[model samples]
Target: MKPDYELLVRGNNLRLKDDFLGMSNVTLIQGPSGPILFDTGGYISRLGLLKALDARGLKPADIPLVFLSHLHFDHAHNVDLFAHAEFLVSRREWDYVGAPHPDDLLVPWGIREQLSKSRVTLIEGEGQIDRGIGFFPAPGHTPGCFAIELDTERGTTVIAGDAIKYAKEAILRRCDMAFDEIEVGTATIRNILDRADRIMPGHFPELVRLPDGNFVWDEAAPFELMVR
Candidate 1:
Protein backbone atom coordinates (compact mmCIF):
# COMPACT_ATOMS: atom_id res chain seq x y z
CA MET A 1 0.00 0.00 0.00
CA LYS A 2 1.13 3.52 -0.74
CA PRO A 3 2.01 5.67 2.24
CA ASP A 4 -0.47 8.27 3.39
CA TYR A 5 -0.44 11.22 1.03
CA GLU A 6 -2.24 14.50 0.57
CA LEU A 7 -3.68 15.79 -2.70
CA LEU A 8 -4.65 19.43 -2.59
CA VAL A 9 -6.38 21.15 -5.49
CA ARG A 10 -6.01 24.76 -6.55
CA GLY A 11 -8.75 25.40 -9.06
CA ASN A 12 -10.57 28.42 -10.42
CA ASN A 13 -11.97 29.90 -13.62
CA LEU A 14 -10.10 32.56 -15.50
CA ARG A 15 -12.37 35.53 -15.91
CA LEU A 16 -10.12 37.28 -18.41
CA LYS A 17 -11.63 37.77 -21.86
CA ASP A 18 -8.62 37.54 -24.16
CA ASP A 19 -7.47 34.04 -23.40
CA PHE A 20 -9.39 30.82 -23.03
CA LEU A 21 -10.97 32.17 -19.90
CA GLY A 22 -12.37 29.20 -18.06
CA MET A 23 -11.79 26.67 -15.31
CA SER A 24 -8.21 25.66 -14.57
CA ASN A 25 -7.02 23.18 -11.96
CA VAL A 26 -3.63 22.57 -10.36
CA THR A 27 -2.83 19.85 -7.89
CA LEU A 28 -0.43 19.66 -4.94
CA ILE A 29 0.68 16.17 -4.04
CA GLN A 30 2.57 15.92 -0.76
CA GLY A 31 4.40 12.72 -0.17
CA PRO A 32 7.71 11.39 1.23
CA SER A 33 10.00 13.66 -0.74
CA GLY A 34 8.36 16.93 0.11
CA PRO A 35 5.73 18.41 -2.22
CA ILE A 36 5.04 17.97 -5.92
CA LEU A 37 3.29 20.44 -8.17
CA PHE A 38 1.15 19.41 -11.09
CA ASP A 39 0.46 21.93 -13.85
CA THR A 40 0.84 25.28 -12.09
CA GLY A 41 -1.73 27.56 -13.71
CA GLY A 42 -1.37 30.32 -16.30
CA TYR A 43 0.26 33.76 -16.27
CA ILE A 44 -2.65 35.40 -14.53
CA SER A 45 -3.04 32.90 -11.71
CA ARG A 46 0.35 33.40 -10.06
CA LEU A 47 -0.91 35.50 -7.17
CA GLY A 48 -3.70 33.15 -6.24
CA LEU A 49 -1.49 30.08 -6.65
CA LEU A 50 1.14 31.60 -4.37
CA LYS A 51 -1.47 32.50 -1.79
CA ALA A 52 -2.84 29.01 -1.83
CA LEU A 53 0.63 27.59 -1.26
CA ASP A 54 1.12 29.95 1.67
CA ALA A 55 -2.13 28.73 3.17
CA ARG A 56 -0.68 25.23 3.19
CA GLY A 57 2.48 26.43 4.97
CA LEU A 58 4.43 26.13 1.74
CA LYS A 59 6.25 28.60 -0.44
CA PRO A 60 7.01 27.98 -4.11
CA ALA A 61 10.67 27.48 -3.28
CA ASP A 62 9.80 24.51 -1.10
CA ILE A 63 8.58 22.37 -3.97
CA PRO A 64 11.08 19.79 -5.18
CA LEU A 65 9.37 18.20 -8.17
CA VAL A 66 6.92 19.45 -10.77
CA PHE A 67 4.94 17.28 -13.18
CA LEU A 68 3.81 19.18 -16.19
CA SER A 69 0.81 17.76 -18.05
CA HIS A 70 1.61 19.83 -21.11
CA LEU A 71 3.20 23.09 -22.16
CA HIS A 72 0.03 25.12 -22.43
CA PHE A 73 0.53 28.55 -20.88
CA ASP A 74 -2.69 28.27 -18.93
CA HIS A 75 -1.32 25.16 -17.27
CA ALA A 76 2.40 25.90 -17.04
CA HIS A 77 3.27 29.57 -16.66
CA ASN A 78 4.42 29.78 -13.05
CA VAL A 79 7.06 27.06 -13.21
CA ASP A 80 9.85 29.43 -12.33
CA LEU A 81 8.37 30.06 -8.94
CA PHE A 82 9.10 26.52 -7.83
CA ALA A 83 12.71 27.51 -7.27
CA HIS A 84 14.03 24.19 -6.03
CA ALA A 85 12.09 21.80 -8.24
CA GLU A 86 13.08 19.54 -11.06
CA PHE A 87 10.42 19.36 -13.76
CA LEU A 88 9.31 16.10 -15.36
CA VAL A 89 7.98 16.86 -18.81
CA SER A 90 7.16 14.58 -21.73
CA ARG A 91 10.05 14.35 -24.20
CA ARG A 92 7.52 14.53 -27.01
CA GLU A 93 6.24 17.83 -25.63
CA TRP A 94 9.70 19.16 -24.93
CA ASP A 95 10.77 18.67 -28.55
CA TYR A 96 7.52 19.83 -30.12
CA VAL A 97 7.62 23.11 -28.25
CA GLY A 98 11.26 23.61 -29.14
CA ALA A 99 9.87 24.57 -32.53
CA PRO A 100 6.08 24.72 -32.63
CA HIS A 101 3.97 25.97 -35.49
CA PRO A 102 2.84 29.59 -35.10
CA ASP A 103 -0.70 28.74 -36.15
CA ASP A 104 -1.63 26.57 -33.18
CA LEU A 105 -3.03 29.10 -30.77
CA LEU A 106 -3.36 26.37 -28.18
CA VAL A 107 0.38 26.82 -27.60
CA PRO A 108 1.60 30.31 -26.97
CA TRP A 109 5.21 31.49 -27.45
CA GLY A 110 5.95 32.49 -23.87
CA ILE A 111 5.30 29.22 -22.08
CA ARG A 112 7.49 27.29 -24.48
CA GLU A 113 10.31 29.66 -23.69
CA GLN A 114 9.88 28.91 -20.00
CA LEU A 115 11.30 25.42 -20.60
CA SER A 116 14.74 26.96 -20.90
CA LYS A 117 15.19 26.46 -17.18
CA SER A 118 17.53 23.60 -16.35
CA ARG A 119 16.96 20.40 -14.33
CA VAL A 120 14.06 19.36 -16.54
CA THR A 121 13.82 15.60 -17.06
CA LEU A 122 12.27 14.59 -20.36
CA ILE A 123 10.05 11.60 -19.63
CA GLU A 124 9.67 9.26 -22.58
CA GLY A 125 6.49 7.09 -22.80
CA GLU A 126 5.90 5.95 -19.23
CA GLY A 127 7.84 6.26 -16.01
CA GLN A 128 7.66 6.80 -12.28
CA ILE A 129 7.94 10.24 -10.75
CA ASP A 130 7.96 8.83 -7.24
CA ARG A 131 6.64 5.89 -5.25
CA GLY A 132 3.20 4.90 -6.54
CA ILE A 133 3.13 7.86 -8.87
CA GLY A 134 3.62 7.38 -12.60
CA PHE A 135 2.98 9.08 -15.95
CA PHE A 136 1.98 8.13 -19.50
CA PRO A 137 1.06 9.86 -22.71
CA ALA A 138 -2.55 10.93 -23.21
CA PRO A 139 -1.98 13.16 -26.19
CA GLY A 140 -4.19 15.08 -28.69
CA HIS A 141 -4.80 18.23 -26.69
CA THR A 142 -1.21 18.87 -27.62
CA PRO A 143 1.38 16.79 -29.47
CA GLY A 144 2.85 15.62 -26.17
CA CYS A 145 0.26 16.03 -23.44
CA PHE A 146 0.21 13.29 -20.81
CA ALA A 147 -1.61 12.30 -17.62
CA ILE A 148 -0.43 11.42 -14.11
CA GLU A 149 -1.37 8.30 -12.17
CA LEU A 150 -1.42 8.56 -8.39
CA ASP A 151 -2.24 5.82 -5.93
CA THR A 152 -4.36 7.25 -3.18
CA GLU A 153 -6.32 6.02 -0.16
CA ARG A 154 -9.52 6.26 -2.13
CA GLY A 155 -7.98 4.33 -5.08
CA THR A 156 -6.23 5.36 -8.29
CA THR A 157 -6.57 8.88 -9.58
CA VAL A 158 -5.52 10.22 -12.95
CA ILE A 159 -4.46 13.81 -13.47
CA ALA A 160 -5.54 14.11 -17.07
CA GLY A 161 -4.42 17.38 -18.56
CA ASP A 162 -6.40 19.22 -21.17
CA ALA A 163 -6.81 15.79 -22.73
CA ILE A 164 -10.16 15.83 -20.96
CA LYS A 165 -10.39 19.48 -20.02
CA TYR A 166 -13.81 19.06 -18.48
CA ALA A 167 -16.11 16.14 -17.69
CA LYS A 168 -18.59 17.61 -20.17
CA GLU A 169 -16.00 17.39 -22.93
CA ALA A 170 -15.22 13.81 -22.01
CA ILE A 171 -18.88 12.79 -21.85
CA LEU A 172 -19.59 14.35 -25.21
CA ARG A 173 -16.35 13.09 -26.81
CA ARG A 174 -15.73 16.51 -28.24
CA CYS A 175 -13.12 19.24 -28.31
CA ASP A 176 -13.13 22.89 -29.29
CA MET A 177 -9.46 22.95 -30.47
CA ALA A 178 -6.08 21.27 -30.10
CA PHE A 179 -2.62 20.86 -31.61
CA ASP A 180 -3.36 17.49 -33.26
CA GLU A 181 -6.44 15.58 -34.45
CA ILE A 182 -9.80 15.58 -32.67
CA GLU A 183 -10.21 11.79 -32.86
CA VAL A 184 -6.95 11.40 -30.98
CA GLY A 185 -8.20 13.61 -28.17
CA THR A 186 -11.36 11.55 -27.76
CA ALA A 187 -9.34 8.35 -27.66
CA THR A 188 -7.09 9.76 -24.97
CA ILE A 189 -10.12 10.69 -22.89
CA ARG A 190 -11.58 7.20 -23.17
CA ASN A 191 -8.26 5.73 -22.09
CA ILE A 192 -8.18 7.83 -18.91
CA LEU A 193 -11.79 6.97 -18.06
CA ASP A 194 -10.87 3.31 -18.47
CA ARG A 195 -7.90 3.55 -16.11
CA ALA A 196 -8.92 5.88 -13.31
CA ASP A 197 -11.78 6.04 -10.80
CA ARG A 198 -11.14 9.72 -10.11
CA ILE A 199 -9.67 12.37 -12.40
CA MET A 200 -7.99 15.72 -11.92
CA PRO A 201 -8.97 17.55 -15.07
CA GLY A 202 -7.05 20.49 -16.47
CA HIS A 203 -9.98 22.86 -16.76
CA PHE A 204 -12.73 21.75 -14.46
CA PRO A 205 -13.88 23.57 -11.36
CA GLU A 206 -14.31 20.16 -9.71
CA LEU A 207 -12.72 16.75 -10.11
CA VAL A 208 -14.34 14.10 -12.32
CA ARG A 209 -15.03 11.72 -9.46
CA LEU A 210 -16.32 8.34 -10.51
CA PRO A 211 -18.34 5.77 -8.50
CA ASP A 212 -19.87 8.62 -6.49
CA GLY A 213 -18.66 9.01 -2.95
CA ASN A 214 -18.64 12.34 -1.13
CA PHE A 215 -17.41 13.95 -4.37
CA VAL A 216 -18.44 17.41 -5.45
CA TRP A 217 -20.02 16.51 -8.76
CA ASP A 218 -22.29 13.72 -7.61
CA GLU A 219 -25.35 15.98 -7.72
CA ALA A 220 -24.90 18.62 -10.42
CA ALA A 221 -25.69 16.25 -13.28
CA PRO A 222 -26.94 12.72 -13.60
CA PHE A 223 -24.51 10.60 -15.57
CA GLU A 224 -23.57 6.98 -16.05
CA LEU A 225 -20.33 5.27 -17.01
CA MET A 226 -19.88 1.53 -17.52
CA VAL A 227 -16.58 -0.13 -16.71
CA ARG A 228 -15.74 -3.62 -17.84
Candidate 2:
Protein backbone atom coordinates (compact mmCIF):
# COMPACT_ATOMS: atom_id res chain seq x y z
CA MET A 1 0.00 0.00 0.00
CA LYS A 2 1.15 3.55 -0.65
CA PRO A 3 1.89 5.34 2.60
CA ASP A 4 0.21 8.67 3.28
CA TYR A 5 2.12 11.97 3.31
CA GLU A 6 1.77 15.62 4.25
CA LEU A 7 3.82 18.80 4.12
CA LEU A 8 4.30 19.62 7.80
CA VAL A 9 6.08 22.89 7.10
CA ARG A 10 6.03 24.64 3.73
CA GLY A 11 9.54 25.98 3.10
CA ASN A 12 10.29 29.50 1.91
CA ASN A 13 13.24 31.17 0.17
CA LEU A 14 12.63 34.65 1.55
CA ARG A 15 15.64 36.53 2.84
CA LEU A 16 16.14 40.02 4.21
CA LYS A 17 19.13 42.31 4.49
CA ASP A 18 21.67 40.78 6.87
CA ASP A 19 19.06 38.17 7.83
CA PHE A 20 18.40 34.84 6.15
CA LEU A 21 14.99 33.26 6.52
CA GLY A 22 16.64 29.85 6.01
CA MET A 23 13.35 27.98 6.35
CA SER A 24 13.35 24.60 4.67
CA ASN A 25 10.32 22.41 4.04
CA VAL A 26 9.55 19.62 6.48
CA THR A 27 7.62 16.58 5.21
CA LEU A 28 5.83 13.82 7.14
CA ILE A 29 5.44 10.41 5.56
CA GLN A 30 3.51 7.58 7.21
CA GLY A 31 5.73 4.58 6.63
CA PRO A 32 4.81 0.94 7.16
CA SER A 33 6.76 0.80 10.41
CA GLY A 34 5.43 4.14 11.67
CA PRO A 35 5.56 7.88 11.09
CA ILE A 36 8.65 9.07 9.23
CA LEU A 37 9.60 12.72 9.06
CA PHE A 38 11.86 14.13 6.35
CA ASP A 39 13.99 17.13 7.31
CA THR A 40 13.03 18.89 10.54
CA GLY A 41 12.97 22.70 10.22
CA GLY A 42 15.51 25.03 11.88
CA TYR A 43 15.28 27.04 15.13
CA ILE A 44 13.46 29.87 13.42
CA SER A 45 10.55 27.54 12.82
CA ARG A 46 10.73 25.85 16.21
CA LEU A 47 7.36 26.95 17.62
CA GLY A 48 5.70 26.74 14.23
CA LEU A 49 7.05 23.23 13.83
CA LEU A 50 5.67 22.16 17.20
CA LYS A 51 2.31 23.69 16.43
CA ALA A 52 2.27 21.97 13.04
CA LEU A 53 2.90 18.60 14.70
CA ASP A 54 0.31 19.26 17.38
CA ALA A 55 -2.20 20.18 14.70
CA ARG A 56 -1.71 16.72 13.25
CA GLY A 57 -2.26 15.03 16.63
CA LEU A 58 1.31 13.93 16.88
CA LYS A 59 4.18 14.50 19.31
CA PRO A 60 7.89 14.29 18.65
CA ALA A 61 8.02 10.90 20.35
CA ASP A 62 5.34 9.63 18.00
CA ILE A 63 7.77 9.83 15.12
CA PRO A 64 9.81 6.65 14.76
CA LEU A 65 12.18 7.83 12.04
CA VAL A 66 13.67 11.18 11.04
CA PHE A 67 15.48 11.56 7.71
CA LEU A 68 17.95 14.33 7.03
CA SER A 69 18.57 15.27 3.42
CA HIS A 70 21.78 16.97 4.45
CA LEU A 71 23.41 18.69 7.42
CA HIS A 72 22.35 22.23 6.61
CA PHE A 73 21.15 24.27 9.58
CA ASP A 74 17.87 25.10 7.84
CA HIS A 75 17.15 21.40 7.42
CA ALA A 76 18.86 19.46 10.18
CA HIS A 77 19.06 21.49 13.40
CA ASN A 78 15.69 20.39 14.79
CA VAL A 79 16.59 16.69 14.95
CA ASP A 80 16.95 17.10 18.71
CA LEU A 81 13.16 17.37 19.06
CA PHE A 82 12.66 13.71 18.27
CA ALA A 83 14.54 12.15 21.13
CA HIS A 84 12.95 8.73 20.67
CA ALA A 85 13.13 8.59 16.91
CA GLU A 86 15.97 6.98 15.03
CA PHE A 87 17.57 9.54 12.72
CA LEU A 88 18.63 8.44 9.22
CA VAL A 89 21.48 10.57 7.89
CA SER A 90 23.83 10.11 4.99
CA ARG A 91 27.14 8.54 5.96
CA ARG A 92 28.80 11.01 3.62
CA GLU A 93 26.96 13.84 5.38
CA TRP A 94 28.18 12.70 8.78
CA ASP A 95 31.77 12.64 7.55
CA TYR A 96 31.50 16.02 5.83
CA VAL A 97 29.96 17.61 8.91
CA GLY A 98 32.85 16.33 11.02
CA ALA A 99 35.22 18.50 9.01
CA PRO A 100 33.12 21.09 7.23
CA HIS A 101 34.80 24.09 5.63
CA PRO A 102 34.89 27.16 7.85
CA ASP A 103 33.07 29.17 5.18
CA ASP A 104 30.01 26.89 5.12
CA LEU A 105 27.86 28.92 7.47
CA LEU A 106 24.68 26.95 6.81
CA VAL A 107 26.08 23.98 8.69
CA PRO A 108 25.39 24.59 12.33
CA TRP A 109 28.28 24.37 14.80
CA GLY A 110 28.48 21.54 17.37
CA ILE A 111 26.45 19.13 15.17
CA ARG A 112 28.43 16.12 16.34
CA GLU A 113 27.90 17.05 19.98
CA GLN A 114 24.20 17.64 19.38
CA LEU A 115 23.48 14.39 17.52
CA SER A 116 25.78 12.27 19.71
CA LYS A 117 22.96 12.19 22.23
CA SER A 118 20.51 10.58 19.75
CA ARG A 119 20.31 7.21 18.01
CA VAL A 120 21.55 7.96 14.50
CA THR A 121 21.80 5.60 11.54
CA LEU A 122 23.98 6.45 8.58
CA ILE A 123 22.81 5.74 5.02
CA GLU A 124 24.87 5.32 1.86
CA GLY A 125 23.92 5.06 -1.84
CA GLU A 126 20.36 4.25 -2.99
CA GLY A 127 17.97 2.04 -0.99
CA GLN A 128 14.39 1.56 -0.02
CA ILE A 129 13.22 2.67 3.40
CA ASP A 130 9.79 1.12 2.90
CA ARG A 131 7.82 -0.61 0.14
CA GLY A 132 6.98 2.55 -1.78
CA ILE A 133 9.57 4.91 -0.32
CA GLY A 134 13.22 4.93 -1.37
CA PHE A 135 16.22 7.27 -1.47
CA PHE A 136 18.76 8.23 -4.13
CA PRO A 137 21.88 10.39 -4.17
CA ALA A 138 21.36 14.02 -5.24
CA PRO A 139 24.33 15.77 -3.78
CA GLY A 140 25.20 19.35 -4.78
CA HIS A 141 24.36 21.82 -2.04
CA THR A 142 26.09 19.33 0.20
CA PRO A 143 28.22 16.34 -0.64
CA GLY A 144 25.78 13.94 0.99
CA CYS A 145 22.49 15.56 0.14
CA PHE A 146 19.99 12.85 -0.82
CA ALA A 147 16.43 13.02 -2.09
CA ILE A 148 13.58 10.75 -1.02
CA GLU A 149 11.30 9.11 -3.61
CA LEU A 150 7.73 8.25 -2.69
CA ASP A 151 5.18 6.25 -4.65
CA THR A 152 1.90 7.97 -3.97
CA GLU A 153 -1.47 7.97 -5.75
CA ARG A 154 -0.35 11.00 -7.68
CA GLY A 155 2.64 9.08 -9.08
CA THR A 156 6.33 9.32 -8.17
CA THR A 157 7.20 12.34 -6.05
CA VAL A 158 10.75 13.24 -5.18
CA ILE A 159 11.33 15.09 -1.88
CA ALA A 160 14.37 16.99 -3.09
CA GLY A 161 15.78 18.70 -0.05
CA ASP A 162 17.95 21.61 -1.24
CA ALA A 163 19.11 19.52 -4.16
CA ILE A 164 16.35 21.13 -6.18
CA LYS A 165 15.23 23.82 -3.77
CA TYR A 166 13.10 25.79 -6.19
CA ALA A 167 10.92 25.06 -9.22
CA LYS A 168 12.93 27.57 -11.20
CA GLU A 169 16.02 25.44 -10.69
CA ALA A 170 14.21 22.39 -12.02
CA ILE A 171 12.72 24.45 -14.82
CA LEU A 172 16.10 25.90 -15.68
CA ARG A 173 17.69 22.54 -15.07
CA ARG A 174 20.44 24.10 -12.93
CA CYS A 175 21.10 24.86 -9.27
CA ASP A 176 21.56 28.47 -8.21
CA MET A 177 23.22 27.66 -4.90
CA ALA A 178 25.92 25.05 -4.94
CA PHE A 179 28.63 24.47 -2.40
CA ASP A 180 30.16 21.99 -4.79
CA GLU A 181 30.82 22.24 -8.51
CA ILE A 182 28.03 24.05 -10.38
CA GLU A 183 28.02 21.32 -13.03
CA VAL A 184 27.49 18.68 -10.35
CA GLY A 185 24.48 20.57 -9.01
CA THR A 186 23.12 21.06 -12.53
CA ALA A 187 23.48 17.36 -13.25
CA THR A 188 21.60 16.48 -10.09
CA ILE A 189 18.77 18.81 -11.07
CA ARG A 190 18.57 17.27 -14.54
CA ASN A 191 18.53 13.78 -13.05
CA ILE A 192 15.66 14.71 -10.74
CA LEU A 193 13.67 16.35 -13.55
CA ASP A 194 14.22 13.32 -15.72
CA ARG A 195 12.87 10.85 -13.15
CA ALA A 196 10.46 12.62 -10.84
CA ASP A 197 6.87 13.07 -11.96
CA ARG A 198 6.49 15.77 -9.35
CA ILE A 199 8.90 17.41 -6.95
CA MET A 200 8.50 18.47 -3.34
CA PRO A 201 11.34 20.96 -3.18
CA GLY A 202 13.29 22.06 -0.13
CA HIS A 203 12.27 25.72 0.05
CA PHE A 204 9.44 26.26 -2.42
CA PRO A 205 5.97 25.03 -3.30
CA GLU A 206 5.53 21.67 -4.98
CA LEU A 207 6.27 21.35 -8.71
CA VAL A 208 4.19 19.30 -11.13
CA ARG A 209 5.51 17.94 -14.40
CA LEU A 210 3.52 19.09 -17.38
CA PRO A 211 2.70 16.99 -20.43
CA ASP A 212 4.88 19.35 -22.43
CA GLY A 213 7.84 18.36 -20.26
CA ASN A 214 7.84 21.54 -18.24
CA PHE A 215 7.73 21.91 -14.48
CA VAL A 216 5.35 24.35 -12.84
CA TRP A 217 4.31 25.11 -9.29
CA ASP A 218 1.22 23.40 -7.94
CA GLU A 219 -1.53 25.46 -6.33
CA ALA A 220 -0.63 26.01 -2.70
CA ALA A 221 -2.22 27.88 0.16
CA PRO A 222 -1.10 31.48 0.45
CA PHE A 223 1.58 32.26 3.02
CA GLU A 224 0.37 34.55 5.78
CA LEU A 225 2.09 36.99 8.06
CA MET A 226 0.85 39.37 10.76
CA VAL A 227 2.15 42.90 11.20
CA ARG A 228 1.61 44.95 14.32
Q: What is the TM-score of each candidate against the true structure?
A: 0.83, 0.95
Q: What clash pairs does model 2 have?
A: none
Q: Pick the candidate with the highest lDDT.
A: 2
* Backbone collisions counted per model: 0, 0
| Local accuracy of candidate 2 as per-residue lDDT tens digits, 73-171 | 899878789877888899988999888766678888888678878899999999999989999989888888999999888888999999998777987
TM-score of 1: 0.83
Once model 1 is optimally superposed onto the true structure by TM-score, how far is the C-alpha of residue 47 displaced, in angstroms? 0.8
User: Top model by TM-score, which number?
Assistant: 2
Q: lDDT of each prediction vs. the true structure?
A: 0.72, 0.87
lDDT of 1 by residue, 1-228 (tens): 462333344454344566555635778876565678888777667887888888988888888888899887788877878746788888998888877756666565766456666488888888887787888998887889988888888678887878877767656667655787788887887787777767777766445454543223442322233599
Q: List where candidate 1 sits over 4 angstroms from the true fold.
A: 1-9, 12-19, 110-113, 208-216, 219-228
